[model samples]
Target: MEKLLKAERISYHADGKKVLENCHIELRRGEIVLLLGPNGSGKTTFFKCIAGILKHSGNVFVDGVNASKMKAHERFRLGVVYSPEKMRVAENLSVKENLAITGDVNEAVEFFPELKKLLKLKAGNLSGGERQLVVLARSLISKPKYLLLDEPFAGLSEKAFERVLKILVEKSEEMGIAIITHERVESVLPYVTRVYSILSGKIVSVIEENFEKELKRYLLID
Candidate 1:
């Protein structure tokens, strides 16, 4: 319980093969790690090599330093938040002015209270689940400690994917989550404790018990 995000032995190559060879990930703090794979499994190239955006070989500790010599906005000011997977709002601004350019949304409006009646509409006229709940309520008011979620349930709506796994399991106690999904680990199965799985490129399995019968016998879940 001392890995506030760590990637060891992470490998990658091109022009010659091997997309990611050794691959590893820890991420703790409060917990919530689930990086399944299938699409060129490197899980978004190990979240772009732990958000430093490419150029990686191994080692990427965050809270324990050595974050590839930090850069991506200094590892996002050391709090480290990367919510990609196509999430960017402010199409014309409005959902409370895009949470007022990310200052405070009263705890992301208490983890999205239907975004307080769509703040006042506009976010490009909302809808893909209210614009992914205003780009995940401005990434939960930018209070991340290590968030890094990617495909947040694609286009959510099984009640907004259970209200975004109950607001990232209450923002993972204090936020130290990592969720790159191809979906169906029974949808964040009980806020996932641990589940790796990446095939071809490495980390073949880590499931931490049952996990829906090991994603239906090795990621065949559909």
Candidate 2:
């Protein structure tokens, strides 16, 4: 597989305190990578930095092209789609319209057929699971080369989690993916090829599937 996204010697600071320091991670095309850390551990910060949502000192490459200086829209055009930590759909727009605005409803539906029926409902009116489905569906319209999702499973029911997980895992073969979550690593363990656990703003651990239990132990929140 080809490497799609790489962050090297990444560091960030705010209010005179370092938020991240000398952190590194790689995402290969068609691969799913996990970013696990406790709150304030720089997980979300890493995602924002890569998506150009925040500024930082580092190098981020997409498909061997350096993209650290690109604007968020430019990065998106380069095939990087970021689903933010908070749900961000039009509250007043119908589901179909939300996707239609992007001009790729059919592509989104190809991954999440269930969205077809919810097309008439406003995004705000959907349940937690349904809302996430809408978000995920809209994200695919970009046909991204890389997808970064922040806490996507939060507030989702067990069944909904499974449903979303299946689509994400399947979609990984077409795009590199990085998902940030603090718990329930089991939900993605089977699909992930590499896991990076962040501690004190650094990637303290990088493990493969065989070491999942240890990784979980290190990141398990009380």
Candidate 3:
């Protein structure tokens, strides 16, 4: 069977500058793939392309069906969800309202029980970490088959990170996850089934074994 979500020969350009060059990736259910790269490595650009936020030269296949022409909303309906690095929510709306726009608020809270109490609070009034949780919760409630998260651990406290990471591991059983994180790489190392390293908008290597050593090599850690 084809991978749940696949992107092939993905290349992108902006202002006549090539940002991504023939990048490819495959995500399978029951696995978490970690994308590691430094800043300005086209990490965010790749996620945007996969989420259909930006048009690029490539084909995106979802479960053997071509979805390259689908709009962002159309892709969302097809069970592909992307949570950006920055928090995105209606400032004036309450947390519950935000989640309700896509799916059941109660179902979303099941993943982050801490959100239950803050449901009534205006999204803008919450702290950065709280807002991140809301964004993640909303994504989870939609029950997407493939999830692309950009910097999901940003602004999260250690305790909160643990909670979120645990929930993500559990959710990976039902969905394929591709996460981009530059900090605390070791924290996510154990849970990831595959690792991809990108530099200058190109995937340099993919490691499925000897993760720590291989990852350090790409990261240039001594």
lDDT of each: 0.78, 0.83, 0.88
Using lDDT as the measure, the top candidate is: 3
Residue 183 displacement (Å), model 1: 5.5
Off by over 4 Å in 2: none
Which rank order by TM-score, best down to worst?
3, 2, 1
Model 1 vs. true fold: TM: 0.32
The digit string of per-residue lDDT tens for model 2 on 1-222 reads: 355788898899999999999889888888999998878899989888888778889999988889999988888888888887666789899999988876588777877788888889888898877777777777867688899999888767787778788888888898899999754677578788898889889988888866567674794533
lDDT of 3: 0.88
Q: For each candidate, how many residue pairs have backbone atoms clashing (under 3 Å)?
A: 0, 0, 0
- Name the top TM-score candidate: 3
Estimated TM-score per prediction? 0.32, 0.90, 0.96
Q: 2 or 3: which has the higher TM-score? A: 3
Candidate 3 minimal-lDDT segment of 10 residues: 213-222
**Could you give candidate 1's per-residue lDDT for residues 1-222 as a string of tens digits?**
365778789887878778998888888878988888778777887887777877777888887888786667778777777777765677787888888775686667777777888788778887777787777778668777888888876778687888788878977888788888776557576777888888888898888778888877884475
For model 1, the superposed segments whose C-alpha errors exceed 4 Å read 1-8, 11-21, 24-34, 37-49, 52-67, 75-81, 84-98, 101-147, 150-202, 205-215, 219-222
> In angstroms, how far off is 192's CA in candidate 1?
20
